[model samples]
Structure formats: C-alpha cells, structure tokens
Target: MRMLRQLLYRLIISLRTFRKKGLRAGFAELGRTISRIFYQRAEFIVIARALLEQIPPAASKQGLVIRRATTREEIASLSPIADMIDMARFHKMFDHGSFAFIAFQNDQPVGYCWVSEEVDRNVTRVQPPLHPGDACVHDLFVSPAHRGRRIGRALVSHRLRFLREHGYKRALAVVRRDNVPALKVDKKTGYTNIGEMSHTRILFWDSFRYNIPDA
Candidate 1:
C-alpha cells in the first residue's frame, strides 16, 4: 500500500512536469522516480546534539502563535497541513505522552514539529539508541507557501525551548544531509553537528550505520 502511494505520487508529479515542461522532461522525471523506488539509494543523515543551555532566549515567532498540541481537534487540524504525520500516528504520540508544537498563522496551520520528551517511554521511532537524559526531535515541517519567512527556524526554536523548560539535559535532532533549510534552522537554534549516518533501504527494511566524530 505504501509503495503504491509512492508510485501514485510519482505519477502525479511526472504528469505535472510533463504538462509544464515537455514529454522528455516528464519521462526523465518518471525514470528517476522509478529508480529511487526500486533501486538501492545512499542517504546521508546527520545527528545534531543540543544541551538545555544552548537554546536561544530571544527565539520568538513574529505574528505567529505556537503551542503544544493537546487535543483531537488540533490533530485533525494538522492532518491536512503536516504531510509526514498521519492521524493514527498523532494519536499514538499523544498516548505516549510525546506532544507536538503546532504553529498557526491567522488561524491557519503553517508548521509543526514533534519531540519525544521521555527517552524511555512510548518512543516508537528512535535510531542509534538514545542515551540517558537524551531525547529525540523529529519531523519539523512548514508549508511550502510559508517558506523563506523563517517559520521553520522559529518552530525549531520553540521546540528547543520546550525541551529546556521540561528539564531535559540533551536533545538529538536527525536531519538529512541534503536538507539545507533544516540544517540552517537546527544550527541557528544552537545545535552542533555531532555525527553522521549512512542509510539504505532494501524493500521494506532499512539499515543505518553511524559515524560519530573520531569513532
């Protein structure tokens, strides 16, 4: 089912590219899409570390309201805007006591991010294993139309503050090596590059190897 959805998305993209560019461009895009879905691909993931003291004190969103998501209504409100998370996963995160920070602009959802506050409990998706006093932050996203406005940076800053206020000693954020925007946001929020990871997927299974500095 997941693969089918991916193929469907690719098909839609290819068609759009075809309509806008030409047949040659569409075929090239489709070929690349198929290769990605079926062939082995190398993915670089970066691990960043942040201490509580690293959070910026002046981190604030201009004309935007952000808060912890604590209600089913908020989950429903985010399902359409957040592409990476689903309704079921949102409920599970809530049940596990891992809450999300939702950002809204003029009553419309613009961006959101999630944090696993408890290192030991209800953490269904953690990689490289979290150490004591360590928490994982994942899936920070902003609407495309709202990009270039620093909304993502503000969202990450807000999340870091949340972790600091909750007394967590350390926070770990995983970002792809090619995600320039996320890397910039994480850096601006006082996170430092600590390690790199190589990832590859074979069918449904993924394998990762960590490369800590000096390790």
Candidate 2:
C-alpha cells in the first residue's frame, strides 16, 4: 500500500512538472520513469533551510560535542559509522572543500553531518542563482541504535549556530520527501520548505532537475 501511494505521488508530481516546464522537461521526466523500470532508480529530493539570523532551538534537545572534522585523522574517528558511509568517498568530498561535523557522546561518535558553502547543484543540470552565505547540508545520519536520542536534531541545530557564528546567512538541507521524521525535525529546527529536486541514475550517467522557487 505504501509503495503504491508513493508511485501515485511520483506520477502526479511528474505530470505537474511536465506542465510547468514544457516539452524538454516532460521528456526528461518521462525518461526518469522509463529508466526506473529498467532498475535505474530516481528519487524526489526536498530542499529545506534555516535563516541563521533567526534559527530556533533543536527539535530534540540534547547536549553533544560536535566537532568539525577537517583532517583525515578526525574523519577516521567516524569509522564506527563506516557501515553506511564510504570513507574513500568522504575523503574525496572533503578534499573538494566539503566539511564534516561529527557528534560525540561519551567519547564515541554518534552522528555526523556534511556541509558545503557552495549550493550543491551537482544533482541537477539547472544553473540556479546561489547566495554566498548559503551552506548546503549534504548529509545527516544517526546510528539506528541511538535513534530516540534526538541526536539528529542536535547535530542540525549545532551546525546552524556554527554557520551563523562564522558569517553564513542561511543553511540548506536535502531530505527525501518520504523521510517524514527528518522533515519534521528540520521544521522544528527552523528550516522552511524551499524547493524540490530529482535525479536519475542510469549506470554511470546521471541527470537532474530542481524546481527553483517562483521560476
């Protein structure tokens, strides 16, 4: 039942996108559906954010020691999270100017978040305007064992405060539309729904589209 509902939702959104974006976008969305049937999957991505000047308290209030992992050794401390994260890929992105924030509890890594000053448009072909102070949240994860601890919310809140202190005006985050819990946490932490994006992965090739607000 859940899967069926999601399919229907995708269909509706795709049709709406087609009507708004014209033939080229229509064909692109059609290709995404066709590719999915061939085992090449795609997903709708939600872009949300907090204006740092007026951020709110965390949805799940918890005290944690969050540190920016810039060096290789600091990042290695997150090996406990290796099951879900690829260390090599993390290293590459870090080298490419992305930053990582690791949260520690009782001296063990509990969660981590990645951010970048650049508004990440790698997922889409569209070239939208970017604000210099915008820091895009690339990923956020909390271990399943520590799920109820409100660690995710803590991480986000801390990151926002850090960005604000360092001169960032706003922060952006990417979440799947289906991730209800995350969306809720984001809202509680002062992130407003800003945009939607989707990307198709076919073998080594990828295509993307992001709906710019009022565009």
Candidate 3:
C-alpha cells in the first residue's frame, strides 16, 4: 500500500513536470527521483586522515591514467558519465567548485567521479553540515565495459590523497545499501560506515528526513 501511494504521488509530480518542462525532461527527472527513493536505504561512511596512510597504494593498471580534470575538453570527454546534463550545466558544476577526476584507458575516457568541499544546500536534498576539513564524494561512475577493474578504487584513492594534500582531515561518501559493488569498493578503500540517512519527498517538497543510528 505504501509503495502504491508513493507511485501515485510520483506520477502526479511527473505529470506536472511534463506540463512545465516537456516529456523528456519530466521522464528523466521522474526516473532519477524514483531511483533515489528505491535506494533510500543507504549508508554514510567517513574515512579519517589516519586511515589515509593505511590504505594500500592504488595498483597501477596498464594503460590506465587517472588525473584531475582541468580543461573543458577533458570535462567534455566525460559525456558518457554526465549524459544527464548539458555541456553548459557541466561547466557550471565546475564553476561552482565541484572538482572532477577522469580515468582514461590508453587515451579513451572510461570512468570518473566528483568531489566537493562545501554543500550546495539549494540543490542537494540532504544538507549535512560539513566541517572545515570534511569533503564529500558523489557521482562516482564507471562504464559498463570497464567494470570489475579497480578503476573506482584508483579514482577514490586519488581523491582522498588530493584532499589530504590540501589539508583536509576527513572524506565522506554515501552508498546505497543495495549497491553491493560500490559498498565493497568503498570498504576496500578504507571508508568506515558512520551512519545512515533517508529522505521522503512529496511533489517538490521533502516531507520527512532523518538519520539512522549506527549499529
């Protein structure tokens, strides 16, 4: 009954979005929202500066090069991962202080991830207060053809090292409980489960939100 009610609510929102933004935009937003609600059961994890030293050095895979994206061309090459947004919006994210790391395999872009030191309270659903030394990792994606390789591990390790070098003391990430692969990768990179959070939304408004105590 609860699931049915949620579906009906989502249908209403999608219809409204369609009238305002057209079918493509409305369906895309609906898909993203549904996916989030489906994965609402998530774990929040944090890695301390001390654990940074304990993490094993990321293995160097042949033909794989991981580096921070600094150019529009490099960012544009990440279209596979950022297909949901236009190039203009992608540039805006960079302009807003969200940094990206791109993975290339023999010159072909395969995967990428993004990190931000400050929360964009206006855009993000969950506005967790970030301390001076804390950074959040989000939007980690790997191409279907490149799964099972430790590309994600390397990307995460690179981000953590970058944060530590810049004087940050901790890194935080959220992973859906059902996403076993992501959970394993984060654990392998030394992130400890810290807590959990879930958000409930009706139309455009968040109805309920709370954190779960760690067991």
Candidate with top lDDT is 1
lDDT of candidate 2 over 72-185, digit per residue (tens): 888888878763225655665677788899988778898898877654443212223357777777568888777778888888888888887788876766677788778877
Model 2 lDDT, full chain set: 0.68
User: Ten-residue segment with the worst summed lDDT in candidate 3?
Assistant: 42-51
Q: Once superposed on the true structure, which residue ranges of model 1 sit more than 4 Å away at CA?
A: 1-37, 40-42, 57-61, 84-97, 117-126, 213-215
* Of candidates 2 and 1, the better by lDDT: 1
Q: Write model 1 residue lDDT over 17-48, tens digit each, in one string.
A: 89999999999999987787765545455565
Q: Could you estimate the TM-score for every candidate?
A: 0.74, 0.71, 0.72
Which stretches in model 3 have alpha-carbon errors above 4 Å?
A: 1-56, 86-89, 212-215
- Give candidate 2 misplaced runs (Cα > 4 Å): 1-39, 50-63, 119-129
- Candidate with the larger lDDT of 2 and 3: 3
Q: Pick the candidate with the highest TM-score.
A: 1
Candidates sorted by lDDT, best first: 1, 3, 2
lDDT of every model, 2 decimals: 0.72, 0.68, 0.69
Report clash pairs, candidate 1. none
Candidate structures ordered by TM-score, highest first: 1, 3, 2
